[model samples]
Target: MNYWLFKSEPDAYSLSDLKNDNNSTGRWDGIRNYQARNLLRDEVKVGDLVLFYHSSCKNIGVAGTAKVVSAPYPDPLQFNPESKYYDPKSSPDKPRWVCLDIQYQQECIKFVPLPLIKATKELDEMILVKRGRLSIQPVSPNEWNIIMKLGKLVC
Candidate 1:
């Protein structure tokens, strides 16, 4: 299965929140960027692993792991007018956004901080280190392995 990194602000939806969800599964939605949306719709799939990164928080880093548990589906919030993620241009017949479910795996034994990742020579090519604004990013197997090791997580 492919590896990915999914970012969420801890205050909005932290790894802890995901772990506390029913069956430790939650919908990953509200992605407004076309690039990130495309990845979720066309590339991400069931059983793929996810590095749950906490961003826009006091402590930003890869906090834990998760597994994609569902295939891509139209984001329900896109049709709701009250939702901030709602798109007036999108409809059920033509969805402009997509999402999926992910189940919490395990919290990292040692939180791999961003500074630590940046300082690690092996991760210099990682997307997070190079261009990190994307909310969802593909992670190479080697990069994944190194990050897991840094987090003290079993691959």
Candidate 2:
């Protein structure tokens, strides 16, 4: 399975919120950027692992892990007029966005802050260190393992 990093704001939807969802799974949706949307629709898949990163908050860092539990599917919110993520031009027959279902794997023993990640020599090549703003990003296996180690995971 591939590795990925999924960023969410703590106030909007924290790692604990994901963990508290029914079966500890929730729809990974509301992505408006074409690049991030494309990753959800075309690349992210069932059983793939995700690093749950908390972004746009006072505590910005990788909070935990999750596993993609479902295949790509049309984001229903795109069709709802009341939704902040709603797209007026998108139709059921031609959806502009897609989402995955992710289940909580485990919280990190210690949150790996952004500063630490940026300072680590092994992670200098990581997308988060350079790109900083993509909501969803692919993570290399080596990067994933190193981050996991920093979070106190044996993997």
TM-score of each: 0.99, 0.98
User: Which of the numbered candidates is closest to the native, going by highest lDDT?
Assistant: 1
Model 1 lDDT on a 0 to 1 scale: 0.97
Model 1 misplaced regions, further than 4 Å: none
Q: By TM-score, who's the top model here?
A: 1
lDDT, candidate 1, 27-70, per-residue tens:
99999999999999889989999999999988999999999999
- Measured over all alpha carbons after superposition, the RMSD of each candidate to the real structure, in angstroms, is 0.5, 0.7
Q: Residue-wise lDDT of candidate 2 within 62-123, one digit each (tens)?
A: 99999999999999999999999999999999999998899999999999999999999999
How large an RMSD does model 2 have? Answer: 0.7
True lDDT of residue 120, candidate 1: 99
Provide the lDDT at 112 for model 1.
94
